[model samples]
Target: MCVVTAAREGQQAGCLVGFASQCSLRPPRFVVWLSKANRTYRVALGAPFLGVHLLRRDQHELARLFGGESGDDVDKFARTPWRPGPGGVPLLTDACAWLVGKVERRADWGDHVGFHLTPVEACADPLPRGPLLCLSDVAHLAPGHPG
Candidate 1:
């Protein structure tokens, strides 16, 4: 699992993203799919940059905070420390690794919207410890939205 965050018009949004991966090696492209029913997708539509965060196993609480809540009704970034990246995307300081990407395209994929982004900037500091968060760990988690 991964966490995707974006900022637009003074609002910040993030969610636990499971349907995301590198799709093109030639162009260094990455894609994160967000449900159409999700609030994040709506905010991301107008965002110039989107941030992808790798969560360490011990950071399950971070995942829960993003995955379990919707930004429409809550300020997910309020309690977190973050700064704007290249395109003004909110990047979390506690992530194992994070990347700021320009949204190259958005495609409708059934109930989810696929956000394909090209990495504009990236940072990696070797994770000191703990495994990356996995899908199984959040199987029982519920999204803040009814969607």
Candidate 2:
């Protein structure tokens, strides 16, 4: 899974996301799927900007931090170094690559809602990075709280 951080209102939100991809090449668009059960999804509903971060292999801790906890219960940003992006979306300071996108549309896709965003601003520091975190890396997941 990859990390996609978003911000809106007075909240900065992020999660370890597995269902996302760059869907269009010409327009350079991406899609992030989120469960309706997540607080991040609720905040993202009206947000104009969302930050997509590609985690380095060493950032497994970051994944656990975001993926294992619910934002409604924890201040996820307080534990990480981040700043507001173009439209106030939180951007991770140390990600391998980051993109600030404008959310163009949202639609329900089965159990998850798909947020399609067009990247308006982006930055990268390709450091011959280690392997990226994937779905398999975080399989058999356990949430920080009991479900």
Candidate 3:
């Protein structure tokens, strides 16, 4: 699982994303699918960049905050530690690894929209504390936006 963040026109949004992966090696590309029902998706539509943050196995609470809560009602950034990244996107401070990606393209795919990204900046902890947070670790979470 990952937390995806974006900012546009003074608004910032983020949410827990389950559908994301490295889609290319050469030129280094990545793709993240955001549910149309999500507030992050709405904000991302106008944003030029996105911050993708990888979580650690022990970051269940962080996942819960992003995954189970709606951005419509809460300011996720205010609840967590983050800083302005490239393109003014919010970058989660507690991520085990993270990347700031330029939005290369947007593809509408049914109930979700896929954002193709080219990495602009990235970081990784030199000594990872633990394994990555996986879907199973967050299976019990109730999505902020349910289809």
Candidate 4:
């Protein structure tokens, strides 16, 4: 799982995403799909950048915070330590690794939206300690948006 964050008009939002992957090799493109019903999707609509984070096995709490809670009723950022990434997107400090990407395009695909991103900046834990969290790790989480 991954946490995708965006900021707009001084407001920030993030949510867990299972539908994201590197989609291109030549020019480097990554796509993260956000549910249209999610608060993060609303903020991301006007955002210039998105922070994509890779969570380690030990960071299950971080997943629970983002995947199990709604930003519409809770400030997901307030519960986690983060810093401004490119274009002021919120980057989770506890993430195993992260990249700030510029929005190349967006597509509406039924219940979800696709964000095509171009990596602009990135940081990874120097030690590269743990295994990245996978779908099974968060399979039990009840989505904050449930869409």
Q: Write candidate 2's Cα lDDT for 20-55 as tens digits.
A: 889999989999998777878878887898888888
Superior candidate under TM-score, 1 versus 4: 4
TM-score: the better of candidates 1 and 2: 1
Q: Between candidates 2 and 3, which one is better according to TM-score?
A: 3
TM-score comparison, 3 vs 4, better candidate: 3
The runs of at least 3 residues in candidate 1 whose Cα sits more than 4 Å from the true structure, single-residue gaps closed, are: none
User: Clashing pairs in model 2?
Assistant: 1-134, 1-135
Off by over 4 Å in 4: none
* Cα error of candidate 1 at position 107, Å: 0.8
1-147 per-residue lDDT for model 4 (tens digits): 899999999999999899999999999999999999999999999999999999997888999999999998898888989998888899899998999889999999999999999999999999988799999999998888765
Best by lDDT: 3
Please, what is the TM-score per model?
Answer: 0.95, 0.92, 0.98, 0.96
The local distance difference test score of model 2 is 0.83
**How do the residues 1-147 of candidate 3 rate in per-residue lDDT, one tens digit apiece?**
999999999999999998999999998999999999999999999999999999998999899999999999998899999999999999999998999999999999999999999999999999999999999999999998868
lDDT string for model 1 (67-106, tens) is 8887877788886788888767888999989988899999
Q: Model 3, poorest ten-residue lDDT window?
A: 138-147
Number of the top-ranking candidate, with TM-score as the measure: 3
lDDT of 2 at 22: 93
How many residue pairs clash per model?
A: 0, 2, 0, 0
State, as a TM-score between 0 and 1, how close model 2 is to the true structure.
0.92
